[model samples]
Target: MKTKKLNVKSRTENLSLIRDFVSSSAAEAGVTSDVIENIILAVDEACTNIIKHAYKSYPDGELIVKTKSTRNRFIISITDYGKSFEPDAIPEPDLQKYYRQKRVGGLGMYLMKTLMDDVKYVSIPGKRNEVQLSKNLKLTQQNVR
Candidate 1:
């Protein structure tokens, strides 16, 4: 597997950098454009969530973006050492209530789950919070899908 890690500050200045890294990594791995887009979108959603929620209180920690790729799969894990949040506890974004309440937020996680093939979160109190995301790309005619 090919792997790379980047440290981002609180300002979200590394969003484009993250996207570029994902795109280049996927392209080199021969991933299709559609698959690459999906991975990038999912990763972006996760990173955005961490920046906006996890580090919202303390803006001094680093947001770790790690990208890993194998022959048939790509995994991106975003780790934050800020507040502990368990993704499992997030209520299914009650879209019905959202529409009735006319709220404009709370859809990042929904999109992440929809776009990524696998999404899992692990939170350790006073330790670390990590969300591992993955996607499987099949090869078609000697090329990645």
Candidate 2:
């Protein structure tokens, strides 16, 4: 297993950097391009939510991202010191209603859930919040050849 970590301020501008890190890490792990894109999107959404909700009042708050990979799986853990949140508490959006009402928000968590193989959230009150997103690399690797 290989592990890498990145720490950045909770600012939107740093999303690109995070995306690039995920892309490179995924590619190096022999993940397919399609899966790589999914991982990137999921991580992006998770970070965006942290910046927008958890650290809403603290732009300078720290956001720590840790990535670990094995032969069959790739996992990313994002940690923030801002307010904690319960991801499972957010009900799935009603697509029909959203389209009818032309709603723009409330899609981040949905996308994260749909794109990654597993999503887990751990919140410790006023201490820390961690969101983990994992992707299965076995199937993607099987399709490589």
Candidate 3:
């Protein structure tokens, strides 16, 4: 298993840097461009959510991004120390309602689920919040609709 870790402050401006790290790591695993793109987008969404929700846009919180790749899959784990929430509590997106309300946000989790083969969340009170995303090396279209 190949592994890499990035420790950076949770700031909106650092999203691009995070993307670049994911891109390079995925490329190193020989992931195709299409799959790599999806993985990148998913990671971006995860980090964005951390910055906005977990860190509450404070910009000074710590964010840890870890990557591990094998012959059959690629995995990304994002951790933060600011806040935590139950993943099951998040309702599925109501796109029509969002459109009617002119809401352009609130779809990060949905988008991450759609773009990755697996998405997992963990929160340990007084410890940290982590979101793990993985992409199978053999997936075609995503499983989620």
Candidate 3 residue lDDT tens string, 64-128: 99999976899999999988967788888899998998875669889999999999999997789
Please estimate how well model 3 matches the true structure, expressed as its whole-model Cα lDDT.
0.89
Q: List the residue pairs that clash in candidate 2.
A: none
Which candidate do you rate higher for TM-score, 2 or 3?
3
The regions of model 2 sitting more than 4 angstroms off are: 100-102, 139-145
Name the candidate that leads on TM-score: 3
How well does candidate 2 score on lDDT at residue 98?
90
Per-model tally of clashing residue pairs: 0, 0, 0
Candidate 2, residue 97: how far the Cα is off, in Å: 1.8
In candidate 3, the residue pairs with backbone N, CA or C atoms under 3 Å apart (3 or more residues apart, or in different chains) clash, namely: none
C-alpha lDDT (0 to 100) for residue 63 of candidate 2:
94
lDDT against true structure, model 1: 0.82
Overall local distance difference test of candidate 2: 0.89
Cα lDDT listed for each candidate:
0.82, 0.89, 0.89
lDDT (tens digit, per residue) of candidate 1 on 44-93? 88877888788883567788888888877888888888788877677778
Lowest summed lDDT across 10 adjacent residues in model 1 is found at: 136-145
